[model samples]
Target: MPRYLSILTFAAALFCGACQNSHSDSKNQSSPEAGVKPAFVAQRGTPVLDGSGSDDLWEASDWLPINQIWAGTLPKPDDFSGRYKLAWDENNLYILAETTDDVLLDVHPQALEHFWDDDCLVVFLDEDASGGTHEFSYNAFAYHIALDGSVADVAPDSSFRYFNDHCLTRRIARDNVNTWEIAVRIFDGKQYKDEGDNVPMLLKKGKKMGFALAYCDNDHSAERESLVGNVPLPNTQNKQQWLNADVFGTLELR
Candidate 1:
């Protein structure tokens, strides 16, 4: 089996960003409430910056084998990928994800699939060694989860399925710029997917799981918080040249 590359401390420090702000209250990471069995994974790689340009925290496939990863993508020259930076401080883990597209994003999820063509960010976190899974998927518009087994997306507005009970928060910003970010906390299966053979897959209390990224066919259709940022956003016309996207954050486990 191939060895899993650990993230370097030098790179991880460079990507560190403060999460304190008016929006910080929306997502709180305090571990599973009391008796709740928190889902978790072992601390894998140290936080690091993965992208082109030494100062750029978002690392492109240039350094690592992008194509080698399942559903991963390589960015074209000039345009950039999403920015990802991770950090963990004793009690909680912090992760930030962002992407830049030459073609402005199409912020809407309707029909069978629409946002599938645009860019997106999919995150998975399992704090415990159990077989359960905690997923947070988002497009340029909104975000959703499969807490346990229920699937949520930005399309058709933010709604919940009867599958299971879990916590979810959606944030949309700079959608016109073709950029977006999400803050998540995986505390328990009840807060995520509530039923069925639900078990932690990629993460465990002591074991570790690899983080992944990819740019494939547009398979998203949902409503998003429109045109953010006062600055003029990138044009989404005929700019076939794909942009680069990366994630950054740290993982802290006990």
Candidate 2:
């Protein structure tokens, strides 16, 4: 695993812009609420990674609505509505998120910079369920999935870290509505030493892992309008509490 020195440096660089904003003014600030318990059904078969959610696994999975606002006021029904389904196999975890938005935007094209400024979905996971670390641990992983289908990580080096040797597949669609599908290997509580390694841990039934989901909404503005998350992210006015694994909720493989 990488040292905390590098992780802190990367976090500082990534969140420097947030320091300028005074969070004391709570006019538009959002807060996380209690999260819902959605059982992760085991995949019956391998679902295609395309953006279309037409597979049998998705049909059987539960679509949990994402309505909590973590950093802005409650959004109107016409503004946005999102729901996601979860399924896991022995080697990988699958996610199919369908969102309804009036406008689809992706201003930030770069992989590692300013992804939150555009519409994006973020998934935080602690594979080992160890929650004492304030910094990113080997077990914790944060994935930023941009509207353009770019995946970026902020821990273990920050700038576009690849999982499963970039075997992850993601697709995005923009029409009257926007939707996305993603599949990535489940990481063990170990770091990939080099390009030659392909180590992964299987998620079994009844095993618990720390998990959280979030989405960023930017409606063609200079800044994002909201940072909606599934779990509470307290003390975010001063720091980026989302980076800490302790803030995430528990996910049991069922």
Candidate 3:
């Protein structure tokens, strides 16, 4: 991956803004995340970033079901189903998810538009596992990764921004299953800046952070049909993860 990919992504975002974004809070970080969140362990290893999940290192991890319903109705297996595996190294957090959706759609090519309404993977992250309302800040990020490999999130300014550089991804679909492999640079939400030069953190063992994973499924519709999460969430029927980081799950770099 290009080391300065974030710069390119940001530049492209600005260009898109020339063509034509609620995100309303700008704290560096927030209070400890709410609730006794689910704890997950990420084994230490580096896997090939290729969408093909053929690496032997993956065997060290287990597939965690991303089956919790956060919105809409529970989709049939043939319609939608997902599970993921996690692994990490000093530079990045790696996620491997296998999802089956009868059809994939990304109507909004513009990242700033209704990104969630399309078929995408939304990754919720709290840098320190200390969460609060980050709707308007970098204290956390809700990365909506589109099928085209573009990543979208609300910047501190509350404007839609593409964080494509933060996430290096690849997707391979075969036999109805789309395997997504993502390598995410762990940035301290408090230190990340859109116009300023920033660096990713060097992760270590036992490091804890708040995170959650989900998918928005839109099978030929004006909007998404279902939203599924990896962990059980409070107010299971209400989707608060986009605004509240307190509802996220905790992860430790093991």
Candidate 4:
């Protein structure tokens, strides 16, 4: 099983809960009676990772070994150049990824309006296998309707069954280095620890936080590179078609 990697790109937006109001008018696109598409559907970005990326940008030694690190099949050693970095602090999580493709250069001029097809990053967190509930997310826009929301085929009109009230604050900034930084801040009901009683128990019982991430450009059929960490994932001994982005010693919590 490939571990997915997540870039925290919405700490501020989550802390503010600003986009929730705008998405209010939007309802599930799939109709139960006739199965109609959504009113407004968006496109996804292309996949650009060829598996040749630098592992040095990560701080692996700091993370706990809940699971073993599994390697995914590389696209081809000499094929293409792709690199990414993962790091964290006591207050925020950071992910820096870069690829050699020029198609990802298209930028979204609007904020909180673009869907998955636009060069975007998705984050999965609070994975709970024992409880039979896993949360999948991308910034504040999430689809809890079905945890089966695979990043492989994310459609803008795809209707999610459950949309959590929680918000994910992120800030995605591009630099001249041809790299982008996705800083995410998770402000779940748990974040209000100062006001909650069970928070301490949740924190001490090894119920901290974890993440999975995937980046895509415009290619809907192209395979995407992903990373997973902290989540008790399934065994990936035979699945070679999908790449695992999750790495040990990669994520941290505040």
Candidate 5:
């Protein structure tokens, strides 16, 4: 049998919440309904990730809504609005996100502590899409991408660590609108190493993975005000995605 999350050794850590939201037991075990997963196709394109979606390949896929409120109160229309597009090639997974916010905050300068409250992007990924609890292992990853281009994730040691090289990000903020372009390199969670050299997988057609995108909004407060996700989760009250891969949406390479 394949090891999805090392479940037999499952032990909830002291800090298992995401964006200050705790995990829910029922939602963590929920899978896609009747095995019918929501599939978003990634168009085959190698676009230039220069904080600007100027490449022609960017038009390949339609903009996906980032309107699902996974945690906290829903913001006003002018307070926050966002949409994103996905594209991939043999080298990397490209993401173009456009967010209009009344204010951008990066309160937590330290990447490891309370980074989720810094108004960043959270990327949830499961290499094989085998849904399970990944609160303390590399079976899946919840990457918190900060505004300063800092990336952090929980390591196998159950401690927060920077995985900056995993995702290269660039953003151009003008007025109150921000255009963020990121190039993501996928790694096998089962084989990922903290101190060892790991090569990212080359994307190909027909490949499937568990994936979701979210944003944390904060306006100078100690905690984030809202958490907007891409997928519509069942429990609108709790953030099950705090550490579960089952709450994410599905993505297939085209």
Candidate 6:
């Protein structure tokens, strides 16, 4: 079986909480019935793609926490914690994630096969905001940032066999803190062909996109112990939300 099908099959056994909010874009502005949908402020200048969090541009951005766990109750701050900030220029969207984990486990070298099983950061992006069942379309994008500073695009089916070279990622781990910086080219939804043939998507004020953030934690184990995300995921009753784009929160360009 294919990787996506295998994941979907596995997700069928997991359980999720009841959804609280109706699907609406404006509800994302404030606290919505579903949950708080954080917004990413646009930056006038691009920040350097270094893993260091010393950029002045990130100083003005808001840090959204990744708190919702897939199965167990929320963990304490001392055990594990993660927060991310976002900024976008004309060409690309920049993301910075600062995470604190007592144990950093990264054993997967091939991103397409086992990155999710390791300690990593995953971002889901629905570029067109269509909110359709994107099983076959290349409308959504999922970028996996491994703890080893390797990056891979996991969305749009084709990425299962191919790796994305356009997206840039960097990471720095010291003590219990891990900092990651990523730059993903914004592509025009109309002309997107594959992960390789990406055209820069021009984002303007008030433009909305389907967005979600997640963290995978593995403590020297064969599989991840917890999968935490910012938004409520689908098929949580039986499976993880790594493949579902429709459950993502709204992200408005500012």
Angstrom error at residue 15, model 6: 23
TM-score pick, better of 1 and 6: 6
- Estimate TM-scores for all models: 0.35, 0.73, 0.84, 0.35, 0.84, 0.76
Give the 10-residue window scoring lowest on summed lDDT in candidate 4. Answer: 37-46
lDDT of 2 by residue, 1-254 (tens): 46998899889977764544433332232322323332233443468887778888788876766666677656676577777877777766777887776676788686566777788888777777776553444567777777656676645443455343433656665654666777756666566443446567766777677777788877878877777766555554325677667777777767
| Model number with the top lDDT | 3
| Candidate 1 segments whose C-alpha is farther than 4 A from its true place | 1-69, 78-80, 88-93, 107-117, 129-181, 190-210, 213-254
Estimate, for each residue in 1-254, the C-alpha lDDT of model 3 and write its tens digit. 58599889988998666533100111111112224467777999999999978898787667887777788878999889998889999999999999999998989876579899999998888989887988889888888999998999888788888998899899998988999999989898888889778889999999999888999999988979999887666666766654787877888999
lDDT of 5 by residue, 1-254 (tens): 34645553343442344313423422432123323555677899887778987778886567877876788888886788888888888888888998888989987786488888889998888989997888789888888899998899877788889989989999999898898999899999899888988999988898998888889988868899898887767667465655788877788888
TM-score of 2: 0.73
**How many backbone clashes are present in model 1?**
61
Model 5 Cα RMSD, 1 decimal: 11.3
Off by over 4 Å in 6: 1-32, 35-44, 71-73, 153-159, 234-238
Residue 225 displacement (Å), model 3: 1.1
Count of clashes, each model = 61, 3, 1, 36, 0, 11
In lDDT terms, how accurate is model 6? 0.68
Sequence-dependent TM-score of model 1: 0.35
Q: Residue 133 of candidate 1: its Cα lDDT?
A: 21
Candidate 4 per-residue lDDT over residues 1-254, each given as its tens digit: 22332223455557346445433422221111112211111112112222222334332322221121122332221221233444444333444444333344223323223333344444444322112122222212222111122222222344332222232222222332234444333445223322234221122122234344433333232332222122223453334212232311112333
Candidate 4 Cα outliers beyond 4 Å, as residue runs: 1-82, 105-114, 127-177, 189-208, 219-254
Candidate 1: 10-residue stretch with minimal lDDT: 224-233
Alpha-carbon deviation at 6 in model 4, angstroms: 46
